[model samples]
Target: MNTPSVELADQVARAARYLRPHIQRSALEGKRELPTPCADFDVHRLSEHLLGSLVAGARAAAKEPLPADAPTTLTEPPWVVFPPLLDSLAAAWAEPGAWKGEALFAGSVRPASFAGTITIMELTVHGWDLATAAGRTFTTDDDVIATATAVAAQIAEGARARGIFGPEAEPAPDAAPLERLLALTGRKSL
Candidate 1:
């Protein structure tokens, strides 16, 4: 099998660092129960979901089998678990062979690059979701924003059908790239 592209793997690593600050305990204070743009998920629930997804992404990158009954929700404080989970994901994807073949994602076989790209999408989008819920400023480099925008567009239709994303909401013409990306994922930028 051909090696998975390093480009997306690098993006995943950058994304992990990009997301770390947003999930800090101090940033999330008093905002645990606040609702986010990601429908039905408050800040805390979304945090748990993000962490769980990171675990799954790491397993996928490492070509490890997913547990039959992995818990979707986290019992531990998300801020505490978030950094390490991000690190795990980034490190797993950085492995030279990680992207060499098909990997399991959401119980289906997909190109390793697909899994990595999706992970990047999750980190950026959910990072925005968490920061927005906490009334914190959210920002990322233009390249990351561009990559996320492309991913959001690629997955918008299928993701909506799977309930991973809601129906697309159009952003204002003058909206920033990050806001436009969020709109594609059915999130209203604050």
Candidate 2:
């Protein structure tokens, strides 16, 4: 049987393939403002943040030293950064053995594998953010959604206990597993 981490990685790859084309064609209006689920970020900033996270995760998975000037704040569009970032992510995931159970950086509380899961969550949610900001819609494969749904259900259980979601935000009555996944992660739609 596949480990949950491996399964989540596969789901993430599927979501990334589904998202890559849309990300490439997305018109990232540099100066124009657009809202995002991440409170401090507008569209451009969020894209940059996503790319930065991807880069970090990829590097960590490779067991490489992080760049000295790694971005601390969001700055660029995903379109400009995703190609290399995605390549790194693919390489990291394709590597043999388990890196997820390893520690992330010097002082992370969670294992590197959990960090990978968070990266997957970030990609899925940010893909939704990009599409929403661009006035477009995107969908994931059902298999990916099923896996994501399982992950999201676990997250939602913890988030609910911690009161992380807002009162106005509720999972739709008949939301698909992916939709619920997104909703649990603070994205309104799938």
Candidate 3:
């Protein structure tokens, strides 16, 4: 990671830890065929994508090659089994220079700056998707939101063009941070 980007990158880990439980209990789980907050992915599709990306994100953080495909679901209580995976991810990135350079993702050598921010985008927005599908609340401190928003602003348009995020839908003038974050990612908060 770029020196200044380290702090924001760390936020991705925090967001992941914060959202894991809600993902475990997501109402969208097991209903793999329903629509999600994102226009392209339905519940089942997003769930699978989320699971695979968790594994991939860890790999990216570790400076390892991301596998072509990752699994969408686990037996149960991944909160217990998945910690090691997350631990590996955290540990990989914990290295002094883990974020020092560009990382491989989906067969592409993405810029160093993209590694953490994209992870934050995927986890935070998809976590919100799961939480919303479950009729739950997803909260974050101002700093996390700031980092997420900043990352969104940096790459959201590119993501949209690449068919990652949906088309931009502006948020209300007075929308809160989380709401602004969601809208930037093309998910309406309301």
Candidate 4:
């Protein structure tokens, strides 16, 4: 086990906090199929991806072997299960080993820091997606938003090329922090 970066783990935990309630709100509102800013994913599919990513993050944090066929969609209601899954992801990332080793993601071995960075992006960006689709407001701490924005900018081009994200939407001159983050992820404020 290798020592982890406390700041990175803190970001993951904070993002989990930011995302949790919106998921519950979306589920309670029964807006699973509504279109999200992601374009390709409805609220349900995006929630499924969030849940799956949390599971993978926890497993990777512990340095456990990843499943070759992890499910991308949830059979259970996301709101019912996602809170705990998000909690576990935060807990796993908090561990010392999670920051120092390589982790498997999308069938590739990536630096553990890379995995952690994307996990933050997943929670914040998709969290915003779910909230928007459900017609709810989303917000997060400044530091959390800052880290997410940096991660988004770092991976935006590659993510776009892989079709995971759409082409970047231009933001207004005075776009807010969250809006800027969303734009980098190819989302426009709804």
Candidate 5:
């Protein structure tokens, strides 16, 4: 029987697959610029970052070497790049004996358990970012949103301490928990 954590990882894998096609349809070509929630990135660059991050996470998950062909220059349109990368990631995560129980990055280390949770949160939030950048909208499944919110709340303390929420912004009283969570993380929606 699969562990609950593995089950959740599988769910995330499925969602990533579902998101791939929509992400590929996003307008990320020349001359048509779209805005992104990330202050420093336009839509295309944000997508590239997301893809790079996904590749990094996949490498961590599988304990595999980073692909030699991975794009070092982060300028490729996400629609042109992410599908194959994400597909490879999904496959890597799905393989038996692939998901290591621990990962090391730079001078830090983390459990694969937490890594999967973080992946879920990253994909959900970045999915929202992609949709916003494209001037489109997409809804995450309730379970995924709840999971992301929980993960976000857990990480918010550190992020908040680092002034991620900005100095003068109080949490919105009327916002839903998820909305508050996103707002606290500096994402105010599309």
Candidate 6:
């Protein structure tokens, strides 16, 4: 973390609003079996993962113990909790010590700032997954994309070799910021 000019928490909130439309639409469509760009997740399953990720992020930011992984989707629709869940993540990170030192991640320790970056990337990348599944466009502010791009590159430096992400496809040098962000994360083709 180079100490971004725009706070990571702020960008997380804005990215949610930008992606909210697509998420709402996909949920409303009720096409649980529809395929998304994320190969392993279908609409319903991805929605469940989205909900879990939201919960995980908020907990991580608050320095709370992360809930154990579950094989369940949310029993009720997530619309009610989704917004506040994202807001909670942002709110927690806005606190003074949220990004300092280390945070717990699924029973292990990780750098808080790096975990925060992963939180943002989850929303940006998976938000795109939801959008693409719903046949919607995925566009957010350049600030969000730029921060995400930088963060993804940093994470990929270590994780790419572990197959945490597929080999990244290059994007054109002049491509839109979001496109580059996606490309660097193994989500877009040049």
TM-score (all chains, Cα) for each model: 0.91, 0.76, 0.82, 0.91, 0.77, 0.85
On a 0 to 1 TM-score scale, where does candidate 5 land against the true structure? Answer: 0.77
Tens digits of lDDT, candidate 2, 1-190: 1456666567657767766865673456453377765545677777766767777777666666568787655454566667766876866865754345564542254566665655666666677777776777767777666555555655676666665443225677997766677666666532
The positional error of residue 111 in candidate 4, measured at the CA in angstroms, is 0.8
Model 5: per-residue Cα lDDT over 1-190, one tens digit each: 1346566667578758656655765344552356676555666666776776687768767775556686645565666667777777677667665545776421257766556566777787777766677666656566666767676777777756865333223566786554654665677654
Show pairs that collide, candidate 6.
none
Better of 2 and 3 by TM-score: 3
Residue-pair clashes per prediction, in order, are 1, 1, 3, 0, 0, 0
Kindly provide the TM-score of model 1 when superposed on the true structure, using C-alpha atoms.
Answer: 0.91
lDDT of each residue in 28-101, candidate 4, tens digit only: 46787788887778878777777788888887777776776766778778777888888888999999888886
Order candidates by lDDT, high to low: 1, 4, 6, 3, 5, 2
lDDT of 5 at 97: 54
Give the winner by lDDT: 1
lDDT scores of the candidates, listed in order: 0.82, 0.63, 0.70, 0.81, 0.64, 0.73
Instruction: Estimate, for each residue in 1-190, the C-alpha lDDT of model 3 and write its tens digit.
Output: 2436557656766876777766563444565555668776766666667767778877887788865456557555444545666566656656656666888876689864577666677777887886776667888667777767887888877889998777777888998888888888888643
Report lDDT (Cα) of residue 190, candidate 5. Answer: 47
Which lDDT tens digits does candidate 1 get at residues 1-190? 1223677678788888878888887888778899998889988888878867898899999988788776677777777777778878888998998877889888899887777778888989998888888888877777677777887788888889999888888889998888888888998855
TM-score of 2: 0.76
Residue pairs with backbone atoms closer than 3 Å in model 4 (clashes) = none
Error of 6 at 56 (Å): 1.5
lDDT of model 6, residue 18: 76
lDDT of 4: 0.81
Q: What's the TM for model 4?
A: 0.91
